[model samples]
Target chain A: MSDHKILQYPKSPYLKTSYYEDTAIQAFDTPFRKKCLVIGLLFWVCFPFVASSYVVHIANLSAIAAIGAMSLNLLIGNTGLLSLGHAGFMGAGAFTTAIMTVQFGLPIWIVIPASGIVGALLGLIAGLPSFQLKGIYLGLSTLAIHHIIKYGCSEYQYYGGFGYGIVLEAPSLGPLLLAGKTVWFFVLWISAFATALLIANLLRSKPGRAWSAIRDRDIAAEVSGIDIGFYKILAFVVSSSLISMQGSLYAYYTAVVSVEEYSFGLTVSYLAMIIVGGLGSVLGSFLGALLITALPYALIILAGLVDLSFAVKEHFSVIQTGVFGMVVILFLLLEPLGLVEIWRRVRCYFELWPFSYKPLTIIKR
Target chain B: MLLASIVVLAGIYALLGSGFVIIYKASRILNFAHAEIVMLAGYLAVSLAVAIPFSAASLLAVLCFCFVLGMSIYAILIRPLAGYSVLSAIILTVAVGVLLNAVGVFVWRGEMEVIPFGWRTYFSLPGNIRLSSIEFATLGIVTLFYACMGLFYRFTKIGQQMRATAENPLLAAQRGISIYRISGIAWGIGFAAAGLAAFLLGINYAISLQIGNIAVAAFVVALIGGLDSLLGTIPAAFIIAATEQLTITYANPRLGDAIPFIIMLMVLMFKPWGLLGTKEELDRV
Candidate 1:
């Protein structure tokens, strides 16, 4: 077992909690969990009502990003495939939605499914390289593929009379035109919530179990009669399709689909979401998406509240990115389990009350 | 003449490509921050040049600084996570790259060309071949530096330890090799090499956020050569550079950036480990 270390997940020093399955050892399956979930849903449901239009816009973005981060988390956190091209998948979905709705005059319902198919097909193309590539090699191959996709889209936009960007004519269902920030907020939140639930259930099911097995040890997973190739492709397919679906919705929400929007920065933000939120947990992805999506606006608001130097204001965007990078690096080095673990420890500490103590088993395990 | 120009670009790539190959060979992590380190080196050298008022000495100072800086990063950030997931290390480097880019933007702003070394643009050689002296100097320096590196890796005691550690760190540790020191050395050499490439590139043209994209090109080179095979990177660098040159010359200049990646995709599909990369070492991940 010691010799087969690659097959085992690296036990973090701080948190030894398993990412997917909740083991009985923790005693976390309780009324408290249900209570928290209920509260969270209520918070999200009431968010648009209490919040300003700008806040609703941010919520809509976060919800869209949550769907993306969840899809990426499935690949990176659950299946252990590292991709630098998450933005590309999202962009593919967005572009597909744009072209379908604008050119073919398709309804939103029809466009979404078509985008999902295109995204899945593109995912298959991306997955093609993964058959041979592993770890860093796979990551780079995906980066190259991302660049190609980016180049293709830009080229298409340039020649196809949509050089600036393809703007979707506001989506509609017969009489009901999907318009306004609040309406889009509800629409995005529903899909994001649905996807989160689906993934939470799926990860505990057969294919998710297969993915976890493959991630832990592909060789062993194969030895154990898991269809490793099938699961890997399935993970990519599921991840890409959902990402595309989010992009399709985003096309309407943002009302703009352009290559510029889906830059490397977009990829990094999605990565930041997954890493910050916690890798494997659906709840983590959702939380991560919200935190990151809201962060820049919060920064801007903070900047306004506290008067900044003229010099600092000149390079504000660069400073923001630098701060963002520092935050991510700090998290990786200090709190690799991310926000979920932080939340868990706080809850556990409160539950333990005045006698907050550590068991020696965690250190020695 | 076009072939000569391709060779010149290849020569520069050989040096740039080494940035990826060196760290990858030892630690098995692709240092994505390398391009920024290259850009950083250029800016550092420029600032030093301004401060010291001596070009040659400042350049050396910048290179040495780059060497120590790389070693420090490995010791502080990378070593702790060595035995853990490769994915974490990879993303860590991405963060490192982003931070470095932010620093670069803050220091130099968006786009600033290198104050080119005198002798300016192109110099016409005999036989109707045009040679840019700065480019030729870069080619000469990079080739010579790599030649020394090749010899050092082949003949030196530390090099032997590096190779042994790369083969299997646990076994190397069992054999009393300081995996930490060897990896630090790998990073030091890697950064120093990248610094040299950056300096040469700055002399030839502009250094900006765009030059960071060259790291992707270098990644393509490293991939083709086999990530771990330093010697393999030599010809692979030239071939990739030449391919890029040919594409730019014959096809669209925009397409030039993508040709190596298209080649990489095809290679990964057929032969994933790369030209001279060790096969069995792959499954360890």
Candidate 2:
């Protein structure tokens, strides 16, 4: 217990209770972390200025995913809930934005918050299964809910024989019609950054510790006087709201709200982001979003540069999927602690220079 | 009478559920890619049907191929992941499913293919109820497999060994039960069941990528029946099939996909252990 480094939540003067800061995310307040954050922020801010429009587009996509991934990390990585229907919330957000904006002529500012509310409502419904179910049952129930949501979305899409999806006019938050690449890039980056910070702060708070307590052991958490059910639902609501907000922004960015785009595949990618990055860490979520977002483009570059046979080039799409699956498998099999664990090891090695310890250092800590 | 629809639909779902049940019983790892593998085997059969003439012998060969494929998948990819968390392994299966889906799109290119199953006859009963020969055969095949599985688990040496391994892997290993062989057998049978369901599905309609999504409904049925209970899928499948069939008949057919899921959620809310799932499973997680 002496080794545990509790987070200092500035506003919450009531909580003197502390828990162990066991992951890279908890070390976020360190001096080295401040330096890294500054450097990372500077790089992202200057990134669009030097990069081409295509690169900017990729960054925009990564930024949206980062926000969504970080939100999901709040639920899955921190709260220890396995939700397979994250896309349901994402789709809900997008549709809320589209319906409010297109049908009621609402502004972007109003629609974003409305979408988050819708997402939180849906999350409450989805979170119901978690109260009575655990593990596989909970996962499947979420999946079923996701399918139900998708069914509703498709019905919306095909309603009145439209034969297609809803298309939105370009989003404008007042005088600015955010159609330009540079403008979209900055707008998306700011939203994602703010989301990351918001989640980080929440994770360092009392509710965060309560969520963690429930995650480590629900029975024990209940005995410790935490309202396990309330906190669990709260985790879902907060995470789902943020995720839906990302979805709404995505709709505005793409200017389209198609049900087909929000499928199980989309959910899988978000899960991949959190798992590959480090489930509970905000930085891991960001890293995962960037990696997964850039993965396809990287594969395309590799394919184009290599003088592969025409047949191989034609089948590159499936090959890329195989490569992606293999990478995830390797991570799960070899490094279950994820990239956050790898990052910790690297930092420790540098700090200890000549006396870097082995995996057993985890226990010694 | 919609009894025909219920019987045919539930039979297929029952087969699909067994695929989930067997692997879960053996390894305790939920294979999210179960349906995808099932879809792949169906595609394999369709491809073979094109190259070689369809016959009972050919069907057996295709199922055998799927069994081998399943064994290798477990041996090569999943076995190495035994050291990781159950959630992580399950996530890996999700990745595998995505990859398999990509392969389905790559190989078939989204076109619907039919396995020339060569069984097109339908037997009609009183009251306008009709059963396609393939559906009838599927019902028979599933029943036979379940009966055999029951006997195997109750009376055979390997069956007892499998039970031991599933109950306590570490203790079973010390007691001379081979986890490798039991897991292999479980995956093989599970894949075989999936292949049979896929084959029947292709014979009834056309095989398409959407088959995987429909097969996902099987998970609902299985969970409601009980994840670990081998025979529990029967009653759960019937309940779901009846509900879905009624929904299709009385309501907008579009809601058919949501019916089973709704039932699953309802069941989970009331009886989380399922109809026959052991009460202790709630604590295992």
Clashing pairs in 1: none
User: What's the i-RMS of each model?
Assistant: 1.9, 2.6
TM-score of each: 0.92, 0.91
DockQ of each: 0.46, 0.52
What are the runs in model 2 whose C-alpha is more than 4 Å off?
A: A1-39, A354-360, A363-365, B167-174
Q: lDDT (0-100) at residue A315 of candidate 1?
A: 93
Where is model 2 chain B poorest over a 10-residue stretch in terms of lDDT?
B50-59
Q: Give the per-residue lDDT digits (tens) of candidate 1, residues B1-285.
A: 896778777877878888888898888889988878988888876667667766678778878998999999999888877666887788788888888889988888867667446575688878888887776787789878978887888899999999898888899999999989999999999999998888887777667778877777887888888888887788888888888889889987767877888888877777787888888755766
Would you list the clashing residue pairs of candidate 2? none
lDDT of 1 by residue, A8-127 (tens): 875533454665434222223556677887888899778888999988888888889899999999999999988888888888888888778778988998999988998898888888
Compute the TM-score of each model's chain A versus the native chain A and list the values.
0.88, 0.89
